[model samples]
Target: MATTNQNGGNRRPRGGRIRAGSSRRAQSEQTELHLLRTATWLFSERGFHGTGIRDIADAAGVAVSAMYYYASSKDELLEAVMRRTLDVLVSSGEETLRDVADPAERLAAVIASHVAFHARNPRAAKVADHEFHALTGQVRQDILQQRDAYETVWSSILSAGVHDGTFKDRGTVARLALLQMTTGVAHWYRPHGELKIPQLCERFAEMGLALMGASREGRALEACDVNLPDTQLLLRRAELTIEPREKPTGL
Candidate 1:
């Protein structure tokens, strides 16, 4: 039997379960997102060893059993968070460099993207940056591989700059320093703080060029005109929301 809904449209019979699949999927996604956000906050605040599955469930307003349905264990949840962060970082890096052919410009764009992502999603960045030690076995190896892939993006840019004489051959040291410097933004950047995202991106991009010894005046000028992507929008589209939490005290 069908019944008239508020819109004066016939509703399917209750036994039919017409909308059940899509409705359940949407609810599942929401629940999973909630769990991820909660776990990211807790892991960032308390460290992996300090946080437990029950803690994540309680904070997320879900039962432990329900949380288990999304992630079988805390390790799995941590892996998911880390993987999501890396996925965004890698994809954004690739997207930023797609049309950028000049080495100096590529390097600047990469730096800007890194800074923007870290500043926008600090907690998730912190977890991805600092919590790898807690993961063990296959998951740990997988995350490390992703980290290496991201590093390769930077390395290739640096290598190109060195090859083209646009940048000094500072080798791996420069690469590591640049990564550390840009990624460190996640530690201290605040949305309402004095430095805005665009400014930070420009300043950091300039600093990166300087660090690379890119002294070609015209090239440096052009390279600073990097187009930083909307990291917040990207994360939101990826279903990764940044939940508000207390300011981090220290590393």
Candidate 2:
């Protein structure tokens, strides 16, 4: 006998896709996300090897084989999380590169975008930065490539600024360090707490510029420094809005 639903029609079992877009992938995606979240908690609480697939399946209320349906292994799940993460970061920075041509402006936008994302999703940030090493073979290489591409974008801008005399930085080392510094925001950012995003961004921007040897002026004169022309030492940032992040396409 066919199993009938409340409407008296025979109902398909779980994971069924049918006409009228009735079985949306959205549910599947949500289930996958749920599984990821549960696994993340487990992995964080217990080491990845310490946590078993059965544990994740039990926590997610899915069968062990069902877990394999979405994620081949815990490592694969981590890669998915990391890939989405890097994609967002790289894409956001790319968008930040579009409008503003100044290296200083580009740098600020990158920092701001990075800070916002990490502050907003610290868990994802933590996992991406730390747990990524847990993946091996090709998955590790893929994550590394994405990360390297992201660094290259920032490096290019910083190098351009140095060449044009807009920014005075040591080299890729310091520039990369500056980029990594923003991740600290992930360690202690609380959304509904004391500081808001805009305020934090401003403070971070000032700190980063200051580190590059830029000084803050008094209230009246200070406003002008934000627009200072590109010299061997200064950058005007008041008008420093970046263009949207875009990817390169074929000619």
List the candidates' TM-scores in order.
0.82, 0.73
Residue pairs with backbone overlap in model 2: 94-245, 95-244, 95-245, 99-243, 226-236, 226-237, 226-238, 227-236, 228-236
Residue 202, candidate 1: alpha-carbon lDDT? 78
Most lDDT-accurate candidate = 1
lDDT of 1 by residue, 91-164 (tens): 87777778888888888878878888888788989999999999898778878998998899899999988897
Alpha-carbon runs more than 4 Å astray in model 1: 1-23, 217-239, 242-251
- Candidate 2 lDDT at 185 equals 81
> What is the alpha-carbon lDDT for the whole of candidate 1?
0.75
RMSD, one per candidate, in order: 9.1, 12.1
Runs in model 2 with CA error above 4 Å? Answer: 1-24, 44-47, 214-251
Per-residue lDDT tens digits for candidate 2, residues 1-251, read: 01356788864332122222247667765666676666656665565778788887887778898776666567666666666667666766666556777666666666667776666656666777778768898768878988888888878877776676665667667666777788888778777888887666656665666555443232211213453222211112211111111211110
Q: Quote the RMSD, in angstroms, for model 2.
A: 12.1
